[model samples]
Target: MVAALLPRERLLMGPGPSTVPNRILRALAAPTLGHLDPQYIGYMDETCELMRQVFQTTNQLTFPVSGTGMAGMETILVNLIEPGDEVIVMINGVFGGRMKDNMERCGATVHAVEIPWGQSFTLDQIRQAVADHPQAVMLGIVHAETSTGAFQDLSGIGELLHQQGMLFAVDAVTSMGGHDLQVDAWGIDAIYSGTQKCLSCPPGLSPVSFSPLALEKIESRTTKSRSWYLDVSMLKNYYTGGGGRAYHHTAPINMVYALREALAIVVEEGLQPRFERHREMHQLLRSGLEELGLEYIPDHSLHTLNCVAVPDGVDEAAIRKRLLNEFDIEIGGGLGVFAGKAWRIGLMGESASEKNVLTMLAALKKCLGD
Candidate 1:
């Protein structure tokens, strides 16, 4: 081995992998527990219960799937979409596009309803699509488009889908813990989220929940799920029953430990208070960005994930590099159609503190020399 790695320490206000809390980091070092150990099983059940509180759902099919956020996306598609099923995917940002790709890969016919990047889908458009494709089995969209920081109205879209008898699925990878996401209240059939964004854990696990109707659809599928590991049928049994010890995979023992500690912190702080913290930090950042004469692409739909428009005569990449190298502050560059135009600043979980907000604003100001 060469010299040990010396990574530069920076305020991670990027698209994801948000700054983790010290307590959660310490928990990652606790003695590893066997996957099926009785104590570990108890921890697992407790984690699921806490997730239900965060998700604001009583859906029994909720748990942490042992992979990244994308795993949660694939889990819903593979388990629910049959070969000939129709899926209407509302595409506004990269994550929505990913959902469409995942659905198509599952051999389902994907009807993509496109919206401009940095914008959100409207309920009228969704209802029109559902009417156009009467046989659609599922409708999918990203609740918070991380690439654009545009939050779609999940309640409106979910209600429209529910009225049409279409299963509502959302990629809440960046929204779950930061924003108000009541899965049952919104009538969401299937939802997925990553631990890193707002949960403040490392990015190894995806927390997913399925409504009973969605589970019924999965159960009644005529074709076997394309991916065996992601199939909810057997995994549900393993996670929910028989002592809550199912050997789906290794289960990432240390990562699970980190997530449990992170969720514990969330519960201790309380979800409502945590959401308010994120909202407050977001407002601070927004005000600072406006003071610097920068504007957001989507003015009305600003999320806790703030995307600021890059100013004229600025090299977006070079400025980000200089900020990291000189000030030890990390912010994300734009993606897709918004590339070279914006920066995604995440105010989530532990990173949503006032100190981080002020630090990032000062660093960004210095970078812009303003």
Candidate 2:
């Protein structure tokens, strides 16, 4: 067999998979232990605890699902949504659209409240939607819309959901470790996150949590979940340690080790500091973009995932390709309606540093011939 060779240098600044820290890479290389070993079980328990801390919740159901962001999204939607159930999904970006698709596939009637791309939903709009669909089982929104770089108003919509006595679920794939995600305080019922974003780990696992109300709904389901592997009911026993250490499936042991180390780095940096660092890097990037005469898509809800509107004469795809070929730096193009209109620059995890911001700015300026 030929030896596997790879590029020695590359910077990951894409939407989902941010640059993994060296510490996490080292942890992945640590001696592999038996998946069911007592020490490994203890490590699993510690990971669960760290997830709760990172999620800012006391929910016992907090654990890393053995998949990517979509896995976490599917796990929550498939188990919580039953046939003919009414799920009110707010769509302002691609992720929201994905949520609608998943919810519909779960046999729920998806009632969508949508706004223009690059814009977020207003409380008034959501209030109207809620009034229109009073029988909706859950209110789902994307906390950080990675596609549009729009941060939706969790406080306003969250209050309305609470008043309507509906479950609140958020797709926090891009916001979990970067922003101040208050799952319990915001009254969120079910939340999902990916390890590849602000977590600074590889993309194999998805950290997920369910509020007591959500867990209760899952437990009280009349029919078995459509997804057997993703059913939280069965998976909980495996993570929380029941008799015989029931093997649901083989866990991604090395990925979990990397994730645990990633979580440790988050704790060391502290969540507030981490959020501030992202904000600072974003500010630097935004300033540089503004200096280059580029404008941001979203207004007040501007996320660290800066989505800059491409100039009229710029070849968006060509520029991205040039950056990849010449600088070995990867940024993202737009999605959905914003395709070819904007560029996505991620400031997540270790990639959320001032040096990276400056490097990206210089590279982009060169790519633009500015």
Candidate 3:
């Protein structure tokens, strides 16, 4: 017989799906509404406005796609790249590699710039890649490489690419609310982010934004996006256009509720203070980990996700097991090249608190002592 589903609750300190606030959970359980209901459409409009504020952009093409972060990636790529177009992909971690794969699937010729897993790409390297591929239509990069905790700087890359008449795209899934990102100020043409990482919400919706330049490219596509499900031109009409509440696919209404509440909390807290909170929490964890003779992996690490090298003779998997089974705390394991050699400890959104940092540090001391 199929039994009722119930999962044990633990402190979520992993790379994503951070602890949700109770208010957002209550919002998720609110009355269900039809996709085109006037009240529901009002909610959708308000949600887009909130996304614009959070993204620090005035772009009119901002909306939450009814899928995970990967869907956002596909949406941006498929809508912009037609067959035979050239693109420059920055691959310093797993997510960047995924971007390259998706670009290839869109039939774009990818010129990849590889870097060590725990390192961010240099401006000179990106400039050189652009010179090598002058015909590139876009440059795709990850702002926060979650797999290795490397924080890539996007300060000048946007203007550089825009000067070359190429689009500036970024994957900010792990850094959105936890780090500093000014979409309009930074000249980011198109960007996407996940709810779970720093929004203290579930992993369902991906907030995406496209500048007018990007929309123009989509409008000029030689062919329709290969994936109709992720086609942005049709999506904009449903999200906000002359069609007026037109139905595409059924929107994830409950996830939308949760996201709205989360964004409200972000507004209430303010962005700068929230980023400072993440910084302080990271410092606490870094000092404690350093005291225990642990070394950080990333050359320039993300304040939200901390990747540390596993000490010699210590069983990385066993330590993580003890932290979960004994302490009821959850952290992430490293991916790709850092697998088995590094542990990822995330201080993101609601989980980036002084108590959690101290608790994790003390718990780790006990486990290591044993």
Q: Which numbered prediction scores highest in TM-score against the true structure?
A: 3
Q: Per-residue alpha-carbon lDDT of model 1 for 1-370, expressed as tens digits?
A: 7998986656788988888888998988889999888888788888888999999999999999989999999999999899988999999889989889899999999999997887877678888899999889899888898888998877677777877789999889998888889898899999999999999898999999999999899879888999988889878876787544557766778888898898888888887888888888888888998999988887445456898889888999998998789888778999998899888888878888889888888888898894
Worst 10 residues of 3 by lDDT: 239-248
Worst 10 residues of 1 by lDDT: 242-251
- Positional deviation of 322 in candidate 2, in angstroms? 1.7
Clashes of each: 0, 0, 0
Report residue 85 deviation for candidate 3 (angstroms). 0.6
User: Which model, 1 or 3, shows the larger TM-score?
Assistant: 3
Q: What is the C-alpha lDDT of each candidate?
A: 0.87, 0.89, 0.92
Question: Would you list the clashing residue pairs of candidate 1?
Answer: none
Best by lDDT: 3
Ranking by TM-score: 3, 2, 1
